[model samples]
Target: MPYSYEPHYFEDLDVGQTFESAGRTVTETDFAMHSMFTGDWTELHTNKEYSEDGPFGARIAQGPMTFILSTGLFQRTGIVERTVVAFLGMNYMDIPNPVFIGDTVSADFEVTEKRDLDSRDDAGLVVIDSEMTNQDGESVFAGDMKFLFKLKSDAE
Candidate 1:
């Protein structure tokens, strides 16, 4: 789905509430730019000719790039928008499949839990389960992400 543009406050999210994001095609630019930005020119990801003889038979995108694209697609869905306070952390991250260039990708997000902050009534903590897939519906990335969010009363 495309962007829905809702600023989700702490109270607005519920466990099991799910969201889907629009697709974005992974490109050579993505691989190259990520390689340039991170200085990760691992032969399997950067040297196509060398990768031709290696596993997967082609250069694959960086695992970090998959995470980046997945998160970017999630934000494109507009769920956080101006509602998010800060990203706390992630848990159990796994990259189960290779993300090749030209593969369109999207994210499926589910709110798994919510917790009240002991020090603040204006903010809360939330956990979301995320799965990223390619056009072929193969799992590329999966994780639980934690975030700090403003409560409804604290949202403007």
Candidate 2:
């Protein structure tokens, strides 16, 4: 089934089309779980009361938590199931608004650039601008990511 539903080749990608996913609500478990992994023990993120007295007036997801969630949300698209060679990295990331616990979040993408790597005939580079938004349509995070994908020729 994975092979049957292989990802599109670089040439097959639609630059202007957006990719999106169902929203996932941030939860206390999400915060605690990620905090353990990242060592982000900020009171503003871990304590609801402490957060309520702070700027956003509620406990919010950590910036890195938002980043990780956004990536996980986007992965539900399974774009890499067929041809992804590697996840390059992210750039120009900003967590503009707080993402509070119970806030539902979703992610979408726009293709920013695509280019065939001269050094690799079987692979190419793809750049995407991704944004994570809350239920109210407020953007909580945004960034650019690059991917190296195996071309159809390489799949053979």
Each prediction's RMSD to truth: 1.4, 3.3
Candidate 1 off by > 4 Å:
1-3
Best model per lDDT: 1
Clashing pairs in 1: none
| TM-score: model 1 vs. ground truth | 0.94
Please write out the lDDT profile of model 1 over residues 55-153, one tens digit for every residue: 899999888888888788778778788888888889788999999888999889999999999988788999989999998899999998898888988
lDDT of 1: 0.88
